[model samples]
Target: MPTVNDVEWDLVGISEIRWMLGGLSRQRTNVIANTKGFPDPIAELEMGKVWLRRDVEAWIRDNRPELLENKKGPTPE
Candidate 1:
């Protein structure tokens, strides 16, 4: 049987998609319209911008270059 290592991270299955959408499901950009602002949390976590598909985390890391070059720990004011 295939394990986690065998599955490509980018080839998300229906079950994987459902799990990822769980967080997006609760977000309410406009509750009146039954609207949702999906991917916002991921954007917030990554930086002010969100990562598109394809490069995924690499795209986010590139967008927030400081995060990559940081010295770790908190910065001094």
Candidate 2:
């Protein structure tokens, strides 16, 4: 099994998700985040919630392919 250090990490929070979803409003992002098919957050932290970037990207790829097609540039870190 992969150890913690061996695993690649690309975690994202609400703001990042907003950007990934093409600058969606916070309310819209929250709604989508709570949607039934959305990926469960990997953790809920003091700041907010976080998800694996890969998982969010996958969900976007499947559900909102047009967003990816119109991506302005690389996602911010």
Candidate 3:
């Protein structure tokens, strides 16, 4: 609730309320994260999307690390 944008912006934000209520747990993080105004709205909702559930990047990292590699280490300009 109290995001990096809130403490410096809104006077009394939802974060304060959560703090007053003895702090929210990690499980509740998703509840608020999916609500609105998160850092990345698209990525936030992607967690709930069935099609975007799995991490393709992780899949690539584990199964296809070769796909991403910086072969060119240095260059003399």
Each candidate: RMSD to true structure? 11.9, 5.6, 16.9
Scored against the true structure, residue 22 in model 2 reaches a CA lDDT of 91
Native-to-model Cα distance after best TM-score fit, residue 18 in candidate 2, in Å: 0.2
Q: Which segments of candidate 3 are over 4 A away from where they belong?
A: 1-50, 70-77
Relative to the true structure, candidate 3 reaches a TM of 0.24
Number of the top lDDT candidate: 2
Query: Which pairs clash inside model 1?
Result: none
lDDT of 3 by residue, 1-77 (tens): 44565433322233442332246664564455454433222222323421111233343345445544533355668
Model 1: per-residue lDDT, tens digit, 20-49? 333223233123113233222223232233
Per-residue lDDT tens digits for candidate 2, residues 1-77, read: 44569757789999999999999999999999999999998889999999989989999999999998786676779
Higher-TM-score candidate of 2 and 3: 2
Clashes of 3: 0
Which stretches of candidate 1 lie above 4 Å from their native place? Answer: 1-7, 10-54, 71-77
Task: List the candidate 2 regions with Cα displacement exceeding 4 Å.
Answer: 1-3, 72-77
lDDT score, candidate 1: 0.35
Overall lDDT per candidate, in order of appearance: 0.35, 0.92, 0.37
- Candidates in order, TM-scores: namely 0.23, 0.84, 0.24
Candidate 1 C-alpha RMSD relative to the actual structure: 11.9
